[model samples]
Target: MTTEQDSRASDAVQLAETTTQPSSVVARTSTWSVWALFCLSVGALALTALRGTQWIVSDILIVDGLTAVMWVVVTFFSGIVHSYSRRYMAGDRDIERFYARVFGFTLVVMTMTAANHVALLAAAWLAMGLLMAGLIGHVRDWEQAQAAATLARRYFLASSALLAGSLSLLAWATGTTSISGILAQADEISTSVALVAVSAIVLAALIQSALFPFHNWLLSSMTAPTPASALMHAGFVNAGGILLTRFAPVVTLEVAVMSAVVLIGAVSALLGQAMGLVQPNVKRKLGSSTIAQMGFMIMQCGLGFFAAAIAHLILHGFYKAYLFLSAGASVEQTVPKDAKSTDTGVSSVAIGAVTAVGAGVVFATLTGKSLLAFDSGTILVLVVVLTTLTATRDILRRAVLPATLRVAAVPIVVLSAITGYALLYNAISTALSGVPMTDAPTELTAAHFLALALFVVAYLATEFGWHRSSTRLYVFLLNRSQPDSSTVLTTKAEYNDV
Candidate 1:
């Protein structure tokens, strides 16, 4: 009798599992559909490139560098996420719905990217938000997922409204609805009109990109499935960068607008990075990282480095997508271990400083470009130098290789990174050469220097406090991240008394 009952229970469990599993045929169909879309988008991108940047079909469609680039990125990543979701969400009852929503969102984003007229762009932008809500709440049974979806929709709605206002102003100023037309008349548009439009665009981009206080929705969105997370971080979050780049001509008209963007972006970057350090969950950590990265990208746009921002957007999209997709394996690799304290000796600090400075000087000399020639070039060199040095130091200190091999590897890695960045930057600059932009104002340059100095000072302070186990700042960050133990204990005691 006991054996019979056990067998029946096992059979019931298996049946439940099978019923919840996604249909193999449905999964295959979804994958193939995305693949077909990807192929079509790629072909369209090539055609657009061949025809040059212009409106097609009577200003109803745009075929420009931004459109071509974004189409390739969105379609490629959509296909990837679709294929990934087939396995990741295999047993999900809503797997079919998830796939449909992802495809729908991708289509809407593509439409937005290809929109020549402001009205079409506005419509597509709003549609993207609606579709995104469905994708975010794919697992509607979860309360957290539903809440995240709601929050995301709220932010997106506000963003859409601001964008609409900007578009209206542009249309009114230019006497035409065409994006190209408005941009062409940027010089003739009254300063007040341009300022209002540019300010609206900046505000819209900030909220859309999840900068600073507006970033909570993005942070809370990790409750979605892995594929959804990947898509959101890699594609959806990049909409602001795309929008700013598309309107570079008009946006660069006002120095004050760019300065505001820079200030907001700098704060977002700093806060995001700090908060990311305290997050215990891997997914949430990545979310914080995305906020920081988007902040930096926006800062680049504000500095009139639209091409550099585009490059950062594409590269970061691919990188963050891979990180999210493989996050499970990463979790396994991150089993808790005893923390080791590394002494930041004067010698080591000196070496790092020298390496960073030397790398920048070498790169500048090799490229035959003056550091002051372009703000983007200067900032890129500083970033690459700092990153390469920091990475080299970390690797060398942790690597188990022979002394000579480790020493050799450092230079090889640093040189390779510098070369790759130089080549990539050059290519992006060439591709976006037609886009009109201006040099950042002197005030903005001063602000950038101030922000950089603060970042460096903060880094040094953190390093100095690393060995102090009782550091107040460290404890505060940790406590803020963790649940309050006192509240939990008090609640338990009260329940016992009751």
Candidate 2:
């Protein structure tokens, strides 16, 4: 009788498992994600080596600090999202094609970021435009799919013209397309003419980065799945920043240029925060953050914060990638199968917490700096640190803590000591970054205070206690999945079978 019951239980559990078929879309996406990661890793190491030596490795075209770093960022995140897609995708279709396109797009953008020559850069831009279109339209069933396609076509049309114009200008101004070669002779170009020509070209690059004043393509791209969204944010959304960095050697800075950079950066940062604060959708909030952070990064470059900007770009890519793809696991839950990807207003506390912490870090950093000066340039290091914090927060929230602390346990003494040191570190860091006696008083600090207060307000808005309806935001929607009740039961039964 015992043996029969055990056999019957085993069949039922296996039946349950087999009954469910993982989404084909997820499987394909997962496979592609992994492949992109692998190939991008190779690209990163190769670019690093080439830049380190400043040598011509023909097949490997990466040549400068700014472009080389973007390439690496793209690849690094490609790997992360791919890794995440494996579990998240589980079972999906078109696996091979998904990776092929992702990797191909990544390679194009990576190469474009580092392309020293106008021709190569143009090629990369065109390819990126195509990739963007494909990513947005990947979900064929959505009504927005056609709109995404139209957006990509528009992007391609503008990018192509921009590429042609920029190339013509480069040839007219510098007499050569090679990056290092032009940089060497950049100063020889007439200052006024060069500024106008290069600005036009760089403006075209902005389409790729989704920088403000040219950000429609990004909003239209929300139809894509989570993995694709990750690629967009961390992999290539900062292409304009990369472009600025590479061309910095040649792009002559005048009063106009400086104003453009600083104002744009500050505006992007503030705009992102404002939009993000009010955003009803999770992915949309993240997308806005990307724009804001990227804005800060480019602004830093304008501010002449080279090292800091690169650090920010690298870290932001990884963290954004993780956040996006990790978010894939929840996409199915967030959307109704009936369609219309509506925001059920799930107050993602974790996301809000991370964002709050990020706001705090930025506030602290700005307090340390002097942005109020009349001739102040971009706040470079702070911008870079901003993205790094975002990435680190995601990694810690997803990969680090849950695996170690939540599912597992820590010794009492070790836990208490960590708490003590963390508090001490924060206190000191805060004191150091806060306003000095000599510094002018401004409202940025007050903004920080308001942000902290808002954090509390956002949490209270969840209103989980009010009610539960069909349209209600699902509890545990923002949180990651745990062992399903059936999985737990099945495992226990299997143990008894053993």
Give one clash count per candidate, in the order shown. 0, 10
Model 1's lDDT to the true fold?
Answer: 0.75
1-498 in candidate 1: lDDT tens per residue? Answer: 699999999999997776555576767776787788778777766665566554466777876667777788898998899888766787777776777788888889989988889999999999998788777777666555676788788889999999999999999988999888888898999999999999999888888888876887787676678898899899998999889988988988888778677767777776666666777778878888888889888987876767667778888899999999999987655567886534235644565566667678776665544677656456546655655565556665666666656555656676766666556655666555455552232333666676566556546644555514546766655443332132122355545642
Model 2 segments more than 4 A misplaced: 1-52, 57-68, 87-93, 328-498
Each model's lDDT comes to 0.75, 0.55
Per-residue accuracy of model 2 over 441-475 as CA lDDT, tens digit each: 22222323333343334234323322123223323
As for model 2, its CA RMSD to the true structure in angstroms is: 13.0
Estimate the TM-score of every prediction: 0.86, 0.61
Top model number, TM-score? 1
Q: How good is model 2 by TM-score?
A: 0.61
Model 1 stretches astray by more than 4 angstroms: 1-21, 24-26, 47-55, 333-337, 341-347, 358-369, 374-376, 438-444, 465-472, 475-498
